[model samples]
Target chain A: MNKGGAFFGVGYLLGLFVALVAFWLAMSGLMKPLLLSLGAVSVAITLFLAMRLDVVDKESAPYLRWPVFIGYWFWLMGEIIKANWRVIRACLRADLDINPALVKVKTRCKSDLAKTTFANSITLTPGTVTLSVEGDKLLVHALYEQDAEPGAFDDMDRRTAAAAEGAPA
Target chain B: MEIWEAFLANFHAWRPWAGALLCVLGAVLVVIGTVGVVRFPDFYTRMHAASVTDTSGATSLLLGMGLMSPDLVTVFKLAAIWVFLFLTGPTATHAIANAAHVAGMQPVTGARARGDVGEREGD
Candidate 1:
């Protein structure tokens, strides 16, 4: 097959795989017939465009270390569940008792990606929001003023830095 | 098939009210999350708003829908959506935060500043 056709063939199969997965899940079976038919033409065009696009640097890809990312994600989930429970309890009580404020935390992680991941993880958890991120410093807004304590945010920062360190980069 | 029919046939007796209540609660949570997103001062805080909506609001909606439908397929779809949200939501937020950090956004400080070890460490 010609090089053009070769790339298109790969893209076509990818789209087909996506369509089948969606169908088996029963979420979008209705689109299967249409997708399967148009998949070839669309995939060809997509591949053509993809071959020409060169926006992001390859080095940035190293930050996406799946194993470490998975561990961090699971840890984040546990924190979210815990925070949700706390929020539910607080919401139920007669006293809202929220001392909302923003606090700053710093990290040793040299990579910007690591610091960002940390800030985002904090945002994912309940009762805490990331207000800003400048360099290695992160400003976190917590539902309870006490939660914004330096110790708390710093602990989170350290965990994120560890996850980043464990990443491929 | 008859058992399945029986289940579906009887769904109307309880499903509607359950679905309505769950949906309302989900809507409320999602609204609150959106409010937080708009009210929060920065991107990091905004992530909190998005996460609450995904976990609390979206979870409530999915659970409510699953309860309304006892079918295996519907339940599976609901579970899948929950799982997908659980997996990707944080990752996306992390990506955004990383972008912000690289762009030079700084974090806010609180009254208990001395406790921050980074400051003492000369970071």
Candidate 2:
């Protein structure tokens, strides 16, 4: 059991290292040997700090579930686009016809990552914004009252739970 | 093979125009969102409008720029920016909204619901 835990820890650390390297390379876009070496040093220092801080864990390095995460991002992009249209319409209308309302959304996600993903997704969408998260409940403010009606966020909550927490879809 | 090549050639010709169109649309969305921020009755509703500029407008602009990028490195950089914005933008917006909520900023809903013009604070 101890050996298995060590191996799992190594996997997460490795994943974090790879992610840091990729991010550094993409942002730097330098192929020169000197610059590459500097980038390597930076990545190493970051990795060392992360290890020392004990943050190289499953939640911090979630790329192991990249497939589900990517799917969720795509779905979320679609939702943002749809919600953008609604808010844009409300914006461009001659009449200031908007009934804003605050609603409580209870999430089924158990993990902190899952709950955060759910709340951020709501805030990411244009028509809705998450005000506060308390335990499993999120206080949401919506531009339209109907958009914040009960059960409106059920699908988002479920999908977020599935993607982030690996709960059943 | 000849037809496929012709389509690919046409696609190359159309790419810049498509990118330009997307950029223009994104600019329009941002302007509309600005209007919403100015015209919306309350803080929360205005936040929703600002998010239009954040999410869709920024996305459209970045996607257009990515399409028009001269090389893969630039595209990758744009993708990184897009990811960063998506991650940080909402968090920042939520921070402001949550602060306001915690400070007891009340939303103006009833006046608009009754088909009257909404009132602003100090009005």
Candidate 3:
């Protein structure tokens, strides 16, 4: 995880605070004054600890680009549905016609967050699994060889880089 | 106008049936995934089969539960479960695959992965 540096601005802290508070409220669903005070205290303690730990950075709180992330998530979900259909068919086919292969895919993501987002998205899609990530190279196992062809992940990689690292789309 | 009015009036009545249908669909997907796991040739391929259950199957079930939920709190909880599952499922799968790779396990690939190879040598 990227720690505090030039990206560790007050905005990130505020964003984290807001997210934590919203999460707490939604999980608890309690508006009582006593419960509210306890929640506030916990949230304050967490924020203080985060500041002391020097982890309040853009990577930690990247909500500024939530719109892009949300859009990418919808696209990813569609990809997942499509991939699921393919895998489901492979699962049901009596012939076992799958041609599984291990392929190394190169990604253009610079930051750890972007790389991780790309890798996780690949793994989340049913047909492909990322075994390991070495620098810009990811060792991917595919249920079907075609799924892991050289340019297969290009679209997802570009979207991930753009969404998580603010790279040019 | 009448059709829209009927749909609006019966929206609540349809919720349970829709929720049940989604749940059944999810169960079927999970069962098919289980079948895939048993039939797939290699560890890597089995993981793919398992993921179908983890992703779409679980998603369908969770969406159904959310729709059937009596209160917003329950829906929120289900959403939280979904977010956490989405985050963790793939990570866990990757970890297992990485471990297998590190242990010198070779996945069957290419033409060899076709139906003839019944048992993996040193599983």
lDDT of 3 by residue, B1-123 (tens): 999999989988988788889999999999999999998887889999999999999999999887788899999999999999999999999999999999989898987887666458774
Provide the TM-score for each candidate, comma-separated. 0.56, 0.91, 0.91
Poorly placed runs, candidate 3 (over 4 Å): A1-9, A48-54, B116-118, B121-123
Q: TM-scores of the first chain across all predictions?
A: 0.67, 0.90, 0.87
- List of chain B TM-scores, one per candidate: 0.74, 0.86, 0.92
Candidate 2 runs further than 4 Å off: A1-4, B1-5, B112-123
Per-candidate DockQ values are: 0.18, 0.68, 0.84
Clashing residue pairs for model 2: none
lDDT of 1 by residue, B17-91 (tens): 788799899998887777666554445445655677878889889888988885767887888888788658767
Off by over 4 Å in 1: A1-34, A44-64, A167-169, B1-51, B63-123
lDDT of 3 by residue, A49-168 (tens): 998897787776676788999999999999999999999999998788899999999999999889989999999999999999999999999999999888999999999999998888
The 0-to-1 C-alpha lDDT of every candidate, in the order given, reads 0.64, 0.86, 0.91
Candidate scoring better on lDDT of 1 and 2: 2
Q: lDDT tens digits, residues A42-149, model 1?
A: 655654564455312222333346687677677776777788766555444443344456667776777777776776677678777665667877766676678777
Model 2, position B95: C-alpha lDDT score = 96
Sorted into a CAPRI-style docking class, model 3 comes out as high
Model 3 scores a TM of: 0.91
Please report the candidate that would top DockQ against the real structure.
Answer: 3
